[model samples]
Target: MIREQLEKADAIEARIQEKKQDGAGPEELEMLRIEKARMLRPLTHPNANERVYLARRIDRPHLKDFIPNLFTDFLEMKGDHLYGDDHAILGGIAFFHGRAVSVVGHCKGHSAEENLACCFGMPRPEGYRKALRIMEEAEKFQRPILTFIDTPGAYPGKDAEEHGQGEAIARNLAAMSRLTVPVISIVTGEGNSGGALAIGVANRILMLEYAVYSVLSPEGFASILWKDASRAPEAAGKMHLTAEDLVEAGVVDEIVPEPLGGAQEDPGRLYASLDKAIQEALCSFDGMMPEEIRAQRWEKFRRIGNGE
Candidate 1:
């Protein structure tokens, strides 16, 4: 059904472009616009697999793209004190609507070279450590921590394991749980496994409309459950991983709505909505004591999966 709608939308779009090139008049353009909208109307109710496809689009905006529009004076911080810098995780300080905050996110690249540079947005032990370091700094300065999660999972490479990848992720979970400063985490894309959770523990958790958060990718889950990775679509349906599903499950505090067709289709509008959501979330913590903030975060996570 989604493919049929896409095809129809694409065909209408092509005709619209062709007409414009041929100096079509306003009436013709208006008619084309109506046709296009009609073709895309059904897309407003995409299924879980369709949402997954949109969430994983390579053109979808990543951390680097969002930071410029949502924050100011972005100064990137690098390197874990214990090891070299991991490009997969970008961490730093920025001012969100004039409020100083620490930001950390998984960053996938647009090009092949850039993907290699960032390890396809798969963090290693060092990457998790770097985020932990920045989070600690935010706590010390009483700055709110904002994390954008968009990773397949932590790097499962041999080197990453040898370097204590599991331990690094575990440390982050513990530290984030206890941090006194308010923490907000948003899953902008693929939020898979402990890699996503390393920076995900927070006072409030938000997810983009089409974004997905799950214990494992659909493919992985399919392989484990049915011994067939090709049944990923089936797994995705059963996983209950969509933003709306997570919200109902109490796994996410809010859903930041994306523009029609998803974030990649209209990033400017998506960014604007995201900025507003972030501001509102931050305002909710105003005047709260440090211990109160910590307690709230702790209780929030404790209630997950409990139908609370």
Candidate 2:
């Protein structure tokens, strides 16, 4: 169903590009707009797989993609100091809404070679270690920390295991939990397993509408439980991975609604709204002491599975 919508949307986009090439009239532009909006109606009412599709949408903006539009003075810091740097996870000191903060997140690549180089945004041991290093620096400077999570999961390869993938994630969780600065996390897209959890132990966690935050991708879960990945849509439905689901379950502090259909449909509006949401969350932590913030976060997670 979502695949069909994607096809239709792509067709409309092509027509719009063609019109631009030929110099479209006002009537042609109007028709194109109406057709695009009509095609999006059903997709806006998305199911589980559609939610996952939006999370991985190629048109959706990424961490690095937002730099020029949403932030400035991005002085990137590299390497974990113990090991080499991982391109999959990148971070730096940046100004968000005129306030300096440590910004870190998964960086998905645009080309096939780039994707392979970054391990398709699936971080390994070095990536997590690098995140910890930058986060500790944020705590030292008394700057707030902001993390953008959009990864399938930690790298699950022989090399990753050899270098302590599990230990890296565990250490990040511990380090982030004890950090004294206010930390805010946003699930901008796919947030899977321990990779997501490592950066998500923040004072407040927010998720974009249509994004998925889960222990495993629906296909993976479906294959394990039903012996058939074809049942992924059903698995997605049962997992409660959508931002709406997380909000209702008290797993997320807030849901930042994407523009009408989704973020990709209107990147400008989406980024503007996201900037506001980040600012508001930061404001909410204004006078909070480190211990108070930690206790609040701890209690918040503890209550997620509370009450049968």
* Backbone atom clashes (below 3 Å) for every candidate: 0, 0
Candidate 2, residues 193-269: lDDT per residue as tens digits? 99889888988888998899999999999999999999998999999999888888888889888875678778888
Model 2, position 194: C-alpha lDDT score: 97
Alpha-carbon deviation at 2 in model 2, angstroms: 2.3
Q: Give the runs in model 1 whose Cα sits over 4 Å from its true position.
A: 7-35
Question: What is the Cα root-mean-square deviation between model 2 and the actual structure?
Answer: 1.4
TM-score result, candidate 2: 0.96
161-254 in candidate 1: lDDT tens per residue?
9999999999999999999999999999999999999999999998999899999999999999999999999999999999989999988999
Local distance difference test values of all predictions, in order: 0.92, 0.87
Worst 10 residues of 1 by lDDT: 1-10
